[model samples]
Target: MFKKPVNDWKTSSPLRSSDRKKLRLKIASSYSIDTAEADVLVPEGILSVKFKSYLNEPGVAYLAPDGDRDPLWFSLGKGSDAQREDALLIPTIYTLWKMPKLLPSLSTPKAVIPIISGGADLMIPGVIHCPPSLNEGQLVSICKYERVDIDGAPTPMLSVPLAVGRMAVGSDQLQDSSQEKGKAVLVLHTWKDHLWELGSKKDVPPSEPIKTEDGAEENEDNTNSKAEEEVEDKSNSEMPANLEPVLPEVKTPTYTPDEVSQLLHMSLVQAITQSLSSLPASAFPIPATIFYTNHILPNRPHFPELVLHPSSPHEPPTADSPSTDSPSPDPSSITIKTSSHKSLTAFLKHAEKSGLISTKAPQKHSTQTDMLVTAVNAAHRDVETHHSFATIGEIEAKAARKAAREEDEKKQRAAANLEIDVQELWKPHLDSVELFEAMGESISKQYTAQEVRSLLNSYFATHQLVNPHDQAYIALDQALTACVIPKPKSKKKSPAEEAPLDQAKVEFMKRDELLKKVLNSMQNWYQVKNGDMGDEVALKKGKLAPIQVVMKMRQGRKASTLITGFEPFNIVAEDLSEDLRKLCAGATSIAPIPGKPANSGMEVLVQGKQSKSVVNYLVGKGVPEKWIEVQDATKGKKK
Candidate 1:
């Protein structure tokens, strides 16, 4: 809209059927088109037409629709009014005043309708409703209050759109009503403007003149005193002569179809380069919150450059402003500029789309959005591929990623197949029957890992081995003291002589220390292979392993008991998180515990000290008690 030169789209390359299809896709993406109207967009009757650009200069525009309905402008390219070839250029006043269906419309209040029609840029406070997706730099059509006939039937002809313009600030900026600040839309064109006159060449029926406009209206019976009074009252209330409306501050879209990716990537490059160049050398692997707070907020450049528009285009010459007496501004439309936070967010979305960065929560099972959206070399490596929207580089990159993933999977499978050495534990009941006293019936059998852990917990709870003041600390009884404290240095050394004579320490073990004591009590057994049953022949030693339940403390000091060995039991994480969120009053993380070996399977992390609660929860959900091991995460040593 300024003094900058432009190229006419009419003079650019001619479009074919395929170009039309691409245009349709861009339209759907740009405007939030619904299913019904999507069917009307096609290429058969498509044609090129000329419309006045935002600067009152002539430029070619595309109309995509069948001959049956009004042909709406779908796309524009190479406009002499803009810097780029693929600009989403529609002035705040021009395109909308002629046909509103060309883009998504936001309705203005009845009182402000005619005023904006006369060409004032919209203020944020005036708008009653705006879609969340509409942000700064987005072009929107302005719709006036609907008109109704005597029978209360909606008047379609009068329902024509009032103006078109770009959003100045996003919806968030308009949250406060008292401020009465910030431009919402920049009107590019309006009804009766030069651009509207040029495009009125089509065979459109004119709106019937209302009887109030010219009294009597060439109809005798319709004329009445009541009608005249109603018209007079309406005119006085709605149309104030001195209250002339002017074009408010607004900018038009410079984004063309092909330029979306290019421009988006350009902004990202600018932001990334700016962000990284100024970053401290030691600030790599930075948390996104800190990165955004420290660098992105203050250093990142203001993106999506703005344009200006005069506040009162229709007003006569004044001391503070110039005259707009002509049909079109001779010099150009008035444009204003401002910085934006919304544009930065848009750039982030673009970066996400191009795989320039990735999001990962900072801590496991954490609700906070302290994510890490770190940039990588792959971003710069793939810039060449973004030139074409549907490029082979993208497809090849996807294929390569898939292949690499398959290679990892193959390696994992090979590793899983290879035999491994393991140690087995068999804690007999006779020697540690005091600890196994809680086992009651099952105390006769050799204890597997789960059984051993369960029996030790039972003994600790039954014998009150834990400090009454603090459950996290255990007061080791004689049964546990022998296992937790080291054995005598020599076989001849008595246990009493070697042990610290000071019972003054109260002989305590922390929760983790008690777990180690329990593990020490179990005896390691051999699962040999390829040998005779007797001692006559040598046997090959094999792996010793059993199902285990483990617990770990996450952020917030919340201890989550993890139930592993669910794979052989066919339990899934999703099914667990789904049902447990209700019972726990919080959403539980049911994804596979990260940083584990491949195919380690998933684990459910219920919130709180949930070892017993989870066991009960699983039992209630019909899980067998034998397969479940409630890893006392509260008692485990730090990993």
Candidate 2:
């Protein structure tokens, strides 16, 4: 369930002393540990974070103890009802690492680690060892297989727990031997998941061989020996007598250009036949880049490798062995450069000649290098006759990607609709002291431009400065002239260029011009309020600084994007980080801006160079386009 990052996360105050004691007692009772031990494990002053796991199930809380950024425990069904008794507390990988023996453990082969991490349950057939004392619904940890040197001989031992969950069936069912096809444990959390990513993101610690009672070790060795014998027997029964024994060393087969071209052709046919329906009509005339990224690459087939057999020289080589070291490559990431075509454009051109797809010509003024794919000929003979190479996992992955894209679009639309109120106000300068006094108001107060205009008009009416001939023009009096017009600079002038003092006539200005002059003479400021209930934040002196998105290359050549200057917009850093994690499908964190006060806002750091996505998200949140600055330091860096 935690395979994806937790959503809607917000930190609350630290738990109270009374509540902390109750929580400790509950933990001790659930894990069958002493109260003192539980107290030592979970100390006081731990922080609580609230989040929503599922959209329908709205109450989930994460507990992060002191000195740790990653949460150690999480509780489900923890809602507003304080007296609710059904809440379930589960330990995270961080907690399990500190106390490896907290729960009974089951051993699984290393081959299934990735599958289990991808959110699959622990199947019975994959389990190599299980404790006989485990009961249904009891909490259990799943450990990986480790080879240990026991008395100079390699012996397999169960490593520390990498995942934690509940037993799916009792030990009686597991020991029956016939029950070899059901689920052994319902996996809830695993290593490298979002929960682990929330922490320091450290690799799994080195395993220490679990110590057992005197005779227990011998019994475990006997069980493993029997299991190995059974596997050997099954393999020997399946092998033909004429075949040579398999070798330990394995090699990835190299493909010739012609074979790669054939694979590319097959992949194109498969995409046109099976994946074209998933694209909407609105997406027609798709660019070559989009077609390659979203369609062709995902449907590409893996090139099978050949196993060597010296005795069967005339016969075809067998398929590659399904060993842990050489796992099947993901077909979604296959590149066209390996094929003879060398690029997507060339491959699509080849397909066009084969009557599989049609391309739209670029316009005369267009800058694009490649033409768009306008249509796919699904009714063509090759498309209809070709066998599909897409697997169930690939199809499901495509659907998931489509769904995630749609959800992100929905969030962007919602953010764009959010209302932001920005008000521009003017504060009176010291030079306007006499003017404010004449208008019967305090010079220390700030006023909106419209309010200042109204005051000026009222003062003009009282002083009768409006021109009798034309109301659009205002006759400037002594105070208005002193405040709006600047003093003349002293300069030597020739007699012919100088104007006589008595010849200076009365200065007259348009009311609109006078208003502009009045506003320019005062201090400019603005306040921003997001939505109706959001607090209004004001900048008293100058314009608000733009939100900055900077991407810097880290030590391993990975890019990390940092965002700052969100305080003026009244955005919470923690909330924004959570949203970005979901949008980018990567880990995110918030830290206090360096050299800034603790009470000041924080800066959000994400794991990748997602400057474009961050900019769009800010704009959708009502930040104007001109108020954002993006800098990418990785632009010219070589991978």
Candidate 3:
């Protein structure tokens, strides 16, 4: 369920005061929550309740917001903490968030962080370490991977007990990989989720440093003044994936383009988002150059001499050193390369014009890219934010929403009406090799282009032939060789001669070209079947199985080889009839098969039983020897 608004939860009513007193009395009698932890939740014996819910029966919660918009705690536990999971003393929850000394801790593997945060049931596969005494339904605080700081210090970046969940299984079972596939935790409260949004939207308090084994407080600090000094200043507190714990808001220093690309490697969209997200408070509507140099360049990937001219390190008039000067302005500096934000800025403006993105327009000359771009709304909103990119948050979320939107559009279109395809797409014939696998050898059938494409898709999945890095690419396996586009023999040149462009020409990566390769890989089966230009008509290469010609006995016991199947060979029944008349001494007739539609099939009927002669005539007519199957009526069997 979506979280209730803060106004609905925030109250200092006398009834709530009485409720807190009663809840505190109940916790003291039942659970192990000491006075300090309970006081943090219900401070000064007053409940400045931010969220209250009796959604879960027999156990309700009163959430107190931290200096940051996040919950302190309340009641609700089940089964066992020191007892059965149910039967609670304020839920058996504990946290290492800000108060490491106040809660039980469990260190999960690196991969499990996003999984639990996204609200999926935490599975055992990603859990590397947990408390030995941790039992089912026990609430535990989750921390990220361990970190090593300078001066040989060890510390973990702590947030409020962001995730408090009941253990799905005992720690011992969690370690058993064979039995570790099921849920490991049922998370109750997580930081940045709906619950947190409804509470204290304040700055994260400075973390309490952890002590090292060497008896030193490696990174702890008691910064926040306790008792009524918990309110924190508001800031855009997004943790960009570039750095570990997001660096607090500051006037981000200007960086060269090379630096920015290193952090954000995907696209211009991500570049802009990371830039605006890391800005100092109230710095919005800044000039494009300031935004680009400070945000984009710093996060972008870098190259040597990206910040200054390559030769700028050595002054031209230096007393002791000779200097080289060049007129080329390329790569002079990030500022020059980005054309004073024109290059990167144009990319965004173009994206906006094309409807590929949505953002507030930059101030003209005042904007023409240099215009002020102020962000009024933060990334958390669904409304078009001022991130300078299309969407908010990380690349994964952007991709997910795009996929969902596309799917919805497809469903809507399908519901509206089926429109005729108007792109005028090209459809090509498959070669002999493709036909063998798709339609099979020695078979007479016609397949449409769509059918062939479906066959190609099936072949790819069944054989597991996909590029490991890019799913869109179909990696050609040995099985695909016969149905894949062949490489053109390169012309031998001088030993010293080389051209990178020539090499690039041979690699096909475009989707349409790759699909074309599927079609081009095939040699026209019809061309191979009929001798249109010469005496020799080709057959499927490496075809061990021959075409079949079988003679079946009629009701009167006379045998004849049906000639209807030769249509796939481009041979007409009329032609076969004429051929039969000559081969059978003018006793051949075109006879139709019953039980089928009119003109369903016609066979060459010879007056006397002569399956062998008919088969020999076909073999002599250029059909492969192995391709003919002679059905001997004498034995009433086909060979």
For each candidate in turn, give its C-alpha RMSD to the true structure in angstroms.
Answer: 25.6, 24.8, 28.0
How many residue pairs of model 3 clash at the backbone?
41
* Candidate 2, superposed: residue stretches over 4 Å from native: 54-56, 78-83, 149-152, 212-639
Q: lDDT by residue for model 1 over 101-195, one digit each (tens)?
A: 46656654455655565656776545543555568877777665324465675331224556667778765565444445557788655554444
TM-score pick, better of 1 and 2: 2
Question: For residues 219-289, could you state the per-residue lDDT of candidate 3 as single tens digits?
Answer: 22221111001211211111111111111121212434544332232233445455555666576565655
Question: On residues 147-179, what C-alpha lDDT tens digit does candidate 2 reach at each position?
Answer: 578899866666678998889998767766566
Off by over 4 Å in 1: 1-14, 32-39, 49-58, 64-71, 74-86, 89-104, 131-133, 146-160, 200-639
Question: For every model shown, what is its TM-score relative to the native structure?
Answer: 0.26, 0.36, 0.28
- lDDT, candidate 3, equals 0.46
Model 1: number of clashes?
Answer: 32
Q: Which stretches in model 3 have alpha-carbon errors above 4 Å?
A: 1-12, 15-19, 29-37, 48-59, 63-70, 75-98, 146-160, 203-639
User: Which pairs of residues collide in candidate 2?
Assistant: none
Give candidate 2's TM-score: 0.36
